[model samples]
Target: MRPFLIALWLLIMPQVVQATTDVYPFESASEQERFRELISELRCPKCQNQNIADSDAPIAKDMRDEVYRMMQDGATDQQVTDALVSRFGEFVLYKPDFNQRTALLWATPLLAVLGGLLVVVGLVIRARQQGGAEPPLSEEERRRAEQLLRDRDGGV
Candidate 1:
């Protein structure tokens, strides 16, 4: 009975230690908080829809470790983020920085909305123009239309 209990404890102890070791390192409370904030603003490359903080993928874990190391080495939050962006490019950042290349990212949706409004306005103006463009009917065509209407209405 004693040996069985000892064996069970040994098995459970290693599992607990392994679980604890799997959590990433942050040097201080401030570092942990900063890491959380930075990671939340970063997209995971392998899991495009997940922020780095929310992803459990190995690449996310590696990115988290890289962030921690940067923080430990006295990198400012912006510097750390810039390092990641430099390595992975703008796609890794949830909120991309403003630059000539990314101007379209910031401008495209507004441009699209404006373009749609212009198209709508053009269509309305054209419709209004067409509505007022009726040509006067010739006497012969008017008489023919009246005859057709009378025929359809049984000469009423």
Candidate 2:
């Protein structure tokens, strides 16, 4: 029983240490909400695809702390975003600003869809022009076909 208690204490000690978080007291409920929103919007530079609010990376922790600090200092949402973007590049934003550089990136899917639509339309038009029925066999070709069939059927 003594050894079991010691082992249980060892197992729980690390969990207690891990459970500690950097708790920032907000000036108001709205301030706390703003903090949550900003962190959720800002991507974690280290995690690439995860928001700072949900990321476990050290960079995310740093970003969260920076956001809290900035908000406490009265930085607006855009200012906080701009600060992170300046430091980490536009990749830190989940939604980057549209610019000449990103114009092609945004336009690619539309272009592809239009191209596909055009191909389908052209195919439909071509199919309509061709029609479902083969052109009426020429009279000469029809006579030759009958002659060949009769010959193969022993002139019947």
Candidate 3:
């Protein structure tokens, strides 16, 4: 029983240590608030939809640590964001700067909606035109169609 308890303790020790997080000492409340806001605004690469502050992934933990360290070292919010963006690309930013690369990401939905509206408008116009215009069949064509209809019914 004693040996089993020792083995259990050994097995659990690593997880216990891993689960503990270090608290960063901020110089002021405003600095701490800024740190919190930054983490919430920064996307976690591994978690995809979750911010670094809300994610439990190892990568998020690393990111949170980096943010804390940068803030503690007196780095500005933009500086920290720039550093992470340089390392992880624009995907790590919840609100990426509008640039040529991300222009399509910001504009595609609006463009698609506009395109769909144009298509619907064109379709409505075409439908109205078709509804109003009825081409008259020639007498010979009418006779042929009637004969075909009669033959179809007779055969059935």
State the C-alpha lDDT per candidate: 0.86, 0.90, 0.91
Task: Give lDDT tens digits, candidate 1, residues 128-154.
Answer: 989977798999999999999999999
> Could you tell me every candidate's TM-score relative to the true structure?
0.68, 0.71, 0.72
* Model 1, CA-based lDDT: 0.86
Q: Candidate 3: where is the Cα deviation over 4 Å?
A: 1-22, 132-156
Q: Answer with 1 or 3, whichever has the higher lDDT.
A: 3
Off by over 4 Å in 2: 1-16, 19-21, 133-156
The better-scoring model by TM-score among 2 and 3 is 3
Candidate 3 lDDT, tens digit per residue, 52-112?
A: 9888789999999999988878899999999999999899998889999999999999999
Clashing pairs in 1: none
Q: What residue pairs clash in candidate 2, if any at all?
A: none
lDDT for residue 21 in candidate 3, whole number 0-100: 67
lDDT of 2 by residue, 4-94 (tens): 9999999999878866776889879999898999999889988859999888778899999999999878899999999999999988888
How many residue pairs clash (N, CA or C atoms closer than 3 angstroms) in each of the candidate models, in the order given?
0, 0, 0
